[model samples]
Structures are given as structure tokens and as C-alpha cells.
Target: MRRRKKKHEDEHMDESWLIPYADLLTLLLALFIVLYAASSVDAQKFKELSQAFNEVFTGGTGIMENPSPGETQPPSDGEVKSSGAEKEEKKEKADLDKEEIERQAFLKDQEELKEIQKKVNEYIKTNNLEVQFVTKLTDEGLLLTIRDNVLFDSGSAVVHSADLNVAKELSELLVMNPPRNIIISGHTDDVPIRNAEFDSNWELSVMRAVNFMKIILENQELNPQWFSAKGFGEFEPVGDNGTAEGRGLNRRVEVLILPRVTD
Candidate 1:
């Protein structure tokens, strides 16, 4: 009976063989689980898990672990460079836009000035006056010229009767289109003058400028806030006083209109 039982036990199982087979099955299951986990991992999550495993096995703290609340993710080298380049491109585009706007505004101002010049020229042409009028565009704005003989008597500060109509017409034009600032400057030849009412050419020139201002201000539509008068006398001469033609050219009054930046 004992010999028969031993033979049945041997046939049923071997203890050493069972141990090795169970170990092999456990190794295969573990290997399959590792492979599955690896397949499911993304680059960002895999990096985090790899750092955790390294810390556990080596008994050392990982630099990538335990980030502060305010700490940002490490940027890739390519991403960092691309962001900087994008910022520079945006700044350049903004600067270009600003320059274009400024250029357009400058062109618009020039067009308005040209229109004003045309209107003033037409008015002078319609009047059959003997005085020579000149118009020019300058940095200060438009300048209009009128000979002294057209407005004033010889060696006198008084405005002539025939020139009254001229003054009234000019005043109307100024009222219609107001400039930023208006300056009336009186100029005289080198000839000296002395009288009971005036001491020298300077005083006579100043009186002439004042009288011209009075005529312009007489118009109720004109604003006196931006108007001024000055006398240069014999100091500022457009031509030499040695000749008759040059003397006539020096004896003149100039009206300057300044542009308004706000407009």
C-alpha cells in the first residue's frame, strides 16, 4: 500500500518543477504589464514617471520633481527662439503702421494749403490794380506781397482812398478762411524821415503797420486774437536802395499766414 501511494504522488506533482513554472508565469505577467504601461505613456507624463522611479531606486531627490506653485514648465529651445522672433515681427509691423498714418496726415495738410493759394491768386487777378502782388509757399506758410505805393502815400503813413476797396476785399477773404496766425510787416527804403508826428523811418513804418491792422480789424467777421503787426523800417530790404527799381521793391508790406497744427 505505501509503495502504491508513493507512485501516485510522484505521478500527480513535482515540488521543484512547480516552483520554477510559477516563477516563469509571474515574470511573464510582470513583463506584459511593463510593456502596456510604456505603450500608454506620453512624453510629458513618461518623463515625470521616470523621475519618480529614479528617485525611489537611487534614494536620491530628483531635480525635476516637487516644483513650486509659481514655477513654469521648462520651455524647449526651439519654442523659446520662436516666441522672441514673433515679438520682434509684431513690433516692426506696429512701427510701420504709425509711420504710414503720419505720412498721410502730412499730405492732407499740403493739399489744403494749395487750395488756399489758388483762391487768393484768383482774387488778385480779378482786380485791375497797378500794384504787383506776389504769393509764395514757405515753411512759415503763405506769404502775400503788396507794393507800398498801392496802399500808402509817398513819405506818409496814411493809406490811400483807392486802396480802401483792396483792404476790404482782402479782409473778407481772411475772414472766410482763417489762418493759424497772421502777421502784417511794414518795410521802408533807406530814405530817412523826420516830422512833428514821427521821429524817423522806424516810427513811420510802425504807424503804417498799425493802420493796416486797423483796417483788417474793422471787419466784424475777422478774429483779432491771432493777428499781429510789426514794422521793420529800413532794416529789412528785399532789394538795394541805390537804384529806382530796387528802392521801389524795398518799399513793400508783407502779409504772412501761419498754418495751424490742430486743424
Candidate 2:
């Protein structure tokens, strides 16, 4: 036996530690998967992870059961609902603030218009031109309506020399604000016209407006760029064409002091 010695049987050590190493590797893989799921916001993946964790830790218990030990619960439904409601409230408040700003601006414009109306009315009273020209504040801004008789004779487009001072007074008023808009519009009675200079009422009305605009421009202080002229022959009548008085009322010129938009 000693001679043989079984060739001093080759000795081997036990490798039982491999089982624990394998288990550690498996746990690390599971941990990495859980960490990835936690960082993501995908609801379906989260549900799958929850079910897998339940199977692994709780022996396949309900999917809603907690998998980790001493872990705090996820956000409650009430918390999520409260977050959405807060966002809605913030939006509503911003909208209301914008509306309030617009309202204040509107009020300020209204006050300014009232002051302009007062000044214009006083001027008309002072000059005793109330019958021929009248001023008023409207939504479209300050309006000055002039009877055709005051600016022209019969079917002519010429500005009467007597009314030239009216243009001067208007130009003086606008010189205070050079950028203010002055829109002159002419209207004529419904009756058709045959003339040597103008073919129809449309031409006569337009020329009438242009001539008056020229008179206002003679001041040289007013900005010509802010002036515009338009004509509505018999189309935009202000009175009935069947009566003489109504026809007189229909033939007129209007000057609009346009309102400015406030920021």
C-alpha cells in the first residue's frame, strides 16, 4: 500500500461558494432592473415591474403589494389630482390679470375721449358754428360733422372762402398732436348729377373731400401723412332722399379724429 500510495490521490477543494456568487449576481441584475424602472415614467412598465417584484418577493401575491422592505408608498391619487388643480388655478389667475389690464386701458381711453369732447364742444360754442358744424365723441372717436352748405355751393367741390377759417381752426387743434389721424369723408344726396367737371356725384363727392383736406394741409403744421380722404356719393346717406330737408341732411362732410390704441 505504501508503495502504491494511490499516487498520493490528487486533492481537490470544495466549490460550494459558487452558489452564493451566482445568487449575488442574480440579485444585482434584479436591482439594476428595479433602478431602471424607478427612473422611468412609463406606467405600463411600472405595472409589469410591480408584478414581477411581487412574484419574486411576496411569493406571487397581489400586484399592488409592496415588494421592498420599509419602503414609503408612492404618491396618492389625491396628490396627483391636487397638482393638476393647482396648474388650472394658475392659468385662470393669469387670464384674469390680463383682462384687468385691458379693462384699465379701456377706462383710460374713455376718460381721454371725454376730455377731448368737452374741448371740442366749447370751441364750437365759442365760434357759434354749431349749426354748420357739430362735434361729438363716439366709439369711433371724436367726430366733426359739417353741413355741405358750409363748405360748398350747389354741386361744386370748391371750399367756400368763408369756411376757410374753419379749416384753419381744425388744423390748429391738430397741430398739438402732429401724428393724430384726420379722416375726411364726403357724402352726397341720392339725386343723380350731370356736370361739366365731374361726371357723377361720386366724383364730386371725392373731389369735395380732397379739396377740404387740401385746405387743412395749408397750415403746414399738421402732418400730411396722417390725413386721409374718402367719399360715399349717394350710398351712405344719413337721411331720407324723399324730402328736401332730409336730402340737405344727407349732403355733408365728416371729419373723424381716430382713436389710438393704448398699450
Candidate 3:
């Protein structure tokens, strides 16, 4: 009977160790579960998981008490560099888009100016005024140059009585849906003037520009605010001041139609 009891006791085989072994296995399983969840869960969940681990471990401390690998951290150098590159790429794209828009606007403005120039050229041809008038489309805008003799006598600022009809006809052409700013500038040859009516060439030039602008503003359809007058006496010349033909070209009144885009 004693031998049989001893055999039973030996067969018991220290089963108490199984409790700690099972606890170790449970801890390992929980650790693996936490590791897997940390990869996919948000920071709040990760912090909750850490708290659970601390409660399960000794003295409210555990390996998970430290930050999770997936938790918020400073950006790596490569990530920072990539962010900067993306910002720069976006800026370049925006600049390219702006440039394309400006290019399209410039093309449209050029076409409009060209159309106006063509109309003026047709008018000049129909009236046989090519010798006294010229039109040019430049970067500044449309420039319509009329010989001084066409509108005024030598050293005079008045538009000739016969030319009043011409001025009125020109004013009729300026009626537009959206009015543009017009600058009437008078230019003169280098010849000095001291007449009874005018003290100097500067005064004569100024009067000519003012008179031409007044004639243009006489049209009820035209806005007086859009018209301005200036004088460039013997300066801003387009021709040589020494030659007769060049002097004839220089002594003119210029009508400059400014682009609407500038406004």
C-alpha cells in the first residue's frame, strides 16, 4: 500500500509549475497582440494599450511604458526632404500656370490692337491720307501719327477750319463699348519758335495736344476722363532733326490708345 501511494505521489509530477508556465504563455500572447495592434491602431488606442500593459506588469511599469514605434516622432531626414521637394514642385507648377495665363492675355491684346490698326489703315486708304497719317502697333500700344500740317499751320496750335470735319470723323471711330484711355501728345521739330501767339515751341506743342484732345472730347460718345494731353517738344523724336523730310516726320501729333489691361 505504501509503495502504491509513493507511486501516485511521483506520478503527480510537480503540476504547480503549470500555473506560472501558463501565465508566461498568456503574457507572450498579449505582447504579440499589442505589437500587431500598435502597427494599425491610432495613438489614443496605443496609449490605452500601454496603460493596460503597465497594469498587468510589476510596479505599474512595462516595456510598453516607453513610446510605441508607431507613435508620433520627429520626421526623418528623408521625409523632411520629400516634404520640401513637394512644396517646391507645387510652387513651380503655380508659376507655370500664371505664365501661361499671361501669355494668353498678351496674345489677345495683340490681336485687338491689330484689328484697330487695320481699321485705321483702311480709313487712311479710303480718304487718300496716307501721306499725312500713319498707324503703328507697338509694345506700348497703338500709335496714330498725323502730320502737323494736316491739323495746324506752321507755328500754330489751332486745328484748321477745313480739318474740323476730319477731326470729327476720326472721333466717330473711337466710340467703343469699353472705352480705352487715349493720350494725345504733340511733338515738334528742333526749330525754335517765338511768335506773337506762342512764346516757344513748348507752348505751341502743348496747345496743339490740348486742342486735338478737345476736338476728340467734343464727341458726346467719348469720355472726357479717358483723354489726356501732353507735349514732347523737340524730344522723343522719331526722325532726325537736321533733315527737312525727317523734320516733317518729327512735327506731328500722336494719338496713343493705351491697353485696357494696363488699367
Candidate 4:
């Protein structure tokens, strides 16, 4: 029997829930990646990254016109040049300060030397020793000149007992200050020497310098290492040897106190 066609019910698909589940999984994965990336950001790099994003999204608008509190822009060329200029200026200022310090020290040394000169002149005048010894302050420093009559006799190297006391007193006064090079230069007249002790004026001058230096070294506290004894002989004679007066002036010993300076 041809029964009325049985009406079959349409089966409903249950896959509608799978679409929302896949979409949620995708959104969760993206959120986890963003959280991980944000967790590792530091201050400076994060600032720069924020600035880059702001510039990209601002579309050249008011948002990007002024930098935000946490945004850091790249260093401009002007800033870099200014930084270099500041360093160079600092170096130049340091050099100028050093030079000024040195200049002040030199001036102070000159003043001290001048005071010492005054004291020395006072002593010479008070003791009536001007005839044998003369002192003056020059650009070189304090100059103490001793004639041959006070230091030696003809070509003798031995210092008299009287001069020994003078040398000792000078050494004591000199040791009152810091150590410096003390140049002891000996000069003589051009006349030939005919003495048994010295064959020529050079030997006589050298021996006299040594003998005088020895007397000065009587002070145990004085440093002998700073002393220099040079025999200028007749070459550095202050006066001509042609006349007796000039020869007398030439026969002398000079003690030079050098000025303080840094090389």
C-alpha cells in the first residue's frame, strides 16, 4: 500500500558552539603574547617604543606634537654637538686653572726671594762686610758675591778659619727654606798662576770652589746633593784682566739661588 510519504524530520547541526570556542582560543593566545612582551620592557627602551607607536598612530596630529612624560625621542644633532662642546670647554678651563696656579706660585717665590735679599743686605750693612761681600736681587734670584780677598789667597784651596764661620752661618740661613739647586761658580783673573798647589787657574778655581763648598757643608742638616761647584776659570770673568782694578773685580765667587719653577 502506497502509504502517505513519511515526513522525515531535518537533523539540526550542533557545530554552532565550535565557532565561538575557536574565536575565544585565538583571543586568549594573542593576550598571552602581549602580556609576555610587556613584562620584559625596560624604562628607556619602553619609552622609545612608546614614542614610536605614538608617532605612527597620531597621524601627524596634536598627540604627537609634544612629547609625553614617558616618551623619549632620539637625540638630535644639536644635542650631540652641544655635548661635545661642553667637554672641550671643560678641558680648556682645567688647563687655564693649572696655568693660573703655576703663575701664582712663581710670583710668590719672587716675593720671598726679595724679602730674603732685604734681610741679607741688612746683615751685610750691620756687620760692615760690604767690602768683602756684596749682595743684590736680580732676575736670576738672590746673588751673593765674595771677593778673592775674603774667600782665598792667590791660588790656595784651603779656606781660612774666619771664612769657615761665615760659610757655616750662610748654610744655616739657607737651610731655613726648602731644598733647591745652589750654584757655586768660581772665577779668576786671566793672569797665569805660578803656585805649587795649582798648575793653572782652572785647577785653582775648581779647588777653591770645592773648599768653599766643604765649609758650607759643615751643617749636618744641609743637603750636599743640591750643591753644584763649577770652575768658570777666567772665561766668565766679570771684568777685563788688562788692569789691576779689573783683575781684582774678576777674582770672585758667586752663589746663585735659583728661582722656583716647574718644567
Candidate 5:
């Protein structure tokens, strides 16, 4: 009995058993605390704690709050795309407007040319003088062709009585609707000439052009400053000089009316 009592006192003095019991109680207390936290979770407090931890780890500001509920801001990417599209549309519209204005201006110029052509055609038809004169619209201007036989004698640069009436009628029309500039060009056949009065076809053609210009300038309605005369001799022939008809075509005087814009 004495030996048993001594052994029981030694066992009671050992602290190993108390340590295991304290550990079990501590684990049970931790489990209860976890269950209590799970049962009564605070969403706002959790979010704040999570944000604070993220800010500390990332070294940045906390998450921002939405300014208004159900009102989202437009994305920067989408805004930039829309702005570029609008600018492109405006640029295209400006280009279209410029093209339209240029087209209208071109049409207006064409109409003015047509009007001038029609008026000259009407004057030619009304006078019943198509046999002695030829009129046509060229790129340069309106051309009036008068036969050399009608205006001058062979190898001479004299203006005849019959030619004066023809010149006067044409001058009257030109004065009525004056152009920016008028050029009287004299031409002759390839037939060579050697005479006491004139040296060659060049002199004869130049004299004939001058004589015709003098008659046209007699009318005060015509502007002398806008008129000029030139002689081509047989250099700028309209047809081949091999045939009689071609020679007739070549031997003619032309009146060229130039546009104001060209001047």
C-alpha cells in the first residue's frame, strides 16, 4: 500500500497529461469561433478588409465606388472609335461639296460657249449668204472664211466693191457681240509670184489682211485695240495644193475670235 501511494503521487506530479487536455480545449474553442464567424458574416467589413489588403500588397489606391447605380460610363476605346468615324464622314462631305462646285462651274462655261455658237449660226442662216462665206465654231474661236477671189484680184491685195458689203455685214455682227480678241489671217495658194508691186505671196497675203482689217476698223462699234492681222501665205493650207478644189480651199481669209478668259 505504501509503494502504490508513492507511485500515484509521482503520476499526479507529471504535466504531460495536462498539456494534451489544454490542446484539445484550445482546438474546440477555435472551431466554435470559425462556426460563429461563418454564421454571421459581414459583407461590407469583409470587402473593406480585402481592399485594404490588396492596396497594401499592390501599393495602389483602393477600389473606387460607382458614381450612380445602373449608369455605366462609356469605354474609352469605344469613344475614340466613334470620334474617328465622325471626322472621316465630315471630310468626305467636304470633298463632295468641292467636286459639285467645280462641276457646276464647268457646266456654266459650256453653256456660254453654246449660246455664242447658236447666235453666229442664226446670223449666217438669216443673211442667205452661205455661198460667199463659210462659218464654223473651232476650239480657238468662231472662224469666218471669206474666199480670196471675193476679196482681192489675182496677185493684187486690193479690196473690191463686192467684198466691202460682205466685210461690213460681218463687222456689224462682230460689233453687236464683241469678243475678247479677233485675228484676221490671210492665206494664199501655193502659186509662186514675181511682180513689180509685190515680191512674193507673203507680201500679197499681208497686204490683203491689212486691207480687210482697215475696212472692219472703219466701224466705230468695233474695238481697234482688240483686233490683229496676220499673213500665212501658203504655209498653213487647209487642203492639199495638188487639186483645183484644194487650191480654192487654201486661198481664203479667216477671222478667229478668241475668248476673254484665254486673253
Candidate 6:
């Protein structure tokens, strides 16, 4: 009897590992189900799912808040209002910052242009060129006006050899830290002309501007790409073309220095 009892005890197999095995199988099955559901889950639901898994694996304390895949708790009225106010405030602040930056840039450009104008003014004063040359700072940019006769002979497109030094000096002043665009425009009086070299005042004005621009660009430091020439003949006059004095003012060339930034 003793031998038979011992044999029966030895025949019993150890089944203690089956508990942990069963637990592992249950965890794996849960993992697969959660992964499958995650495919169609919304943003809120995915967040909740992530928290749920974290709590389970970490053995932390939290109520398993497994809401439906598409269901989400909306914010209260007060929260909605606060969020909107915050967004609007942020937008206004951003706009103000942008405007301030633009303002600073415009002011900086204006200051630089003013310095350039001062230099040109000094040159004009030293040379006693007040009657022939004038400078104005306008919203568009700096305007340097010269009587046509100062640079060109009457009814001629060619720049006078005597005034080549003037153009060269102006070109030297134009060299700056940051170069700006320059335009040389020509204007003519109302008197009509049909010369051998020019068909009309229009042709004369255009050639005069082009020739002046060429002289300015002869300075190796000046970029030809930044210089352009145009003509407005007897149409966009600064003075009346009816009188001789007014006509003298009307027949002029303008050197316009444009601002790098504008309002």
C-alpha cells in the first residue's frame, strides 16, 4: 500500500505554470484587439487608448476611460470662449509685430536715403549748382533734378563734355553699403522738333536719359543692372511749358533713388 501511494503521488504532473500561461494569453489577446481598434480611432480616442495601455502595463492607478472610437467630450462654453479669445489675441499680437518690423525697415531706408541726399546737396552747394541742380525727398524716393542745359546742349541728346565730371562725382556718391535702384528720366518742353538726329522731342529726351545713365554707369562700382532710363516728353512736366522760364524747368533730367522698402 505504501509503494502504491508513492507511485500515485509521483504520477501527478505540476500544473502551476498554467496560471501564468493563461494570463499571458489573455494579455496578448487584449493587445491584438486594441491594435485592431486603433486603426479606426479618432485623435481623442487614440489618446485615451494610449493612456489606458500605459496604465495597464505600468500597474498604475486610473479608471480605464475607454470611450467610443468617435465619441469625444466637447469643451464647456467657458473653455470655448477662452480658447477663442486667446487665438484672437495671438493673431493681433502677430499683426502688430509684423507692422512694427515694416515700420522699422521703412525708417531705416529713409534715413539712408537722407544721408545720400545730404552728400549730394553738399556737392551741389560747393559747386554753386543750386540753379542747375535740386534735390527733393518724397514718398516715392529721392529726386535729383538737373536742368537739361547743364548736361546737354540745347536741342541735343549728347551730354556736354564739360559736365562729365558732375555725373562721375554723383556716381561716386551713389555707392552705398546696400545699393538701391536708380532711375534716370528725361523730360522735354512743348516745342516740337524734327532734327536730323531726332525725329521729335520724345527721341531726344530718351537718348538724353540713356546717355546720362551710361555716363553714371561708367563708375566701376556702380551696377548697370540697377540703373534704368525713361523719358516723358512734354507730357509730365514739373512746370508750365507756355513760358520760357517754365519751359527751362520743363526740359530737365531726373535722377531718382528708390527706397529699398516702402510703406
Give me the candidate number with maximum TM-score. 6
Error of 1 at 168 (Å): 0.6
lDDT of 2 by residue, 147-254 (tens): 999989999999989889987887776664426677999999989999788888998899999999998899887778899999989999878999999899889998
- Estimated TM-score per prediction? 0.64, 0.69, 0.75, 0.69, 0.58, 0.76
Summarize candidate 5's per-residue lDDT along 47-75 as a digit string, tens digits: 44445444654465543221223233355
The count of residue-pair clashes in candidate 4 stands at 0
RMSD of 6: 7.3
Q: Candidate 2: what lDDT? A: 0.83
Displacement of residue 187 (Cα, Å) in model 3 is: 0.5
Clashes of 5: 0
Question: Of 4 and 6, which scores higher on lDDT?
Answer: 6
What candidate 1 gets wrong by more than 4 Å, as runs, is 1-96, 177-179, 261-263
**lDDT at position 115, candidate 2:** 74
lDDT of 4 by residue, 54-144 (tens): 5655654545345455444567799999999999999999999999999999889888778777777777787788898888777787788
lDDT digits (tens) for residues 1-263 of candidate 1: 45543455546555688888998997687567545545663546645654665476446565435433443356789999999999999999999998887777766766776777787788888875435787887777778888999899888888898888888888876764544588999999998888787788888888898898899889998889888999999999899899989889988888887765322
User: Candidate 6: misplaced stretches above 4 Å?
Assistant: 1-63
Question: Which pairs clash in model 5?
Answer: none
Question: Which 10-residue window in model 3 sums to the lowest lDDT?
Answer: 1-10
Task: Give, for candidate 2, the lowest lDDT window spanning 10 residues.
Answer: 63-72
Task: Give the alpha carbon lDDT tens digit for every residue of 70-178 in model 6.
Answer: 5555887999999999999999999999999999999999999999999999999999999999999999899999999999988998889999999899899888767
TM-score of 6: 0.76
Q: What lDDT is reached at residue 4 by model 3?
A: 44
- Please list the Cα RMSD from the true structure of every candidate, rounded to 1 decimal place: 8.8, 8.4, 7.4, 8.6, 15.1, 7.3
Instruction: For model 4, state the Cα shift of residue 159 in Å.
Output: 2.0
Error (Å) of candidate 2 at residue 260 is 1.3
Candidate 2 displacement at residue 99 in angstroms: 1.9
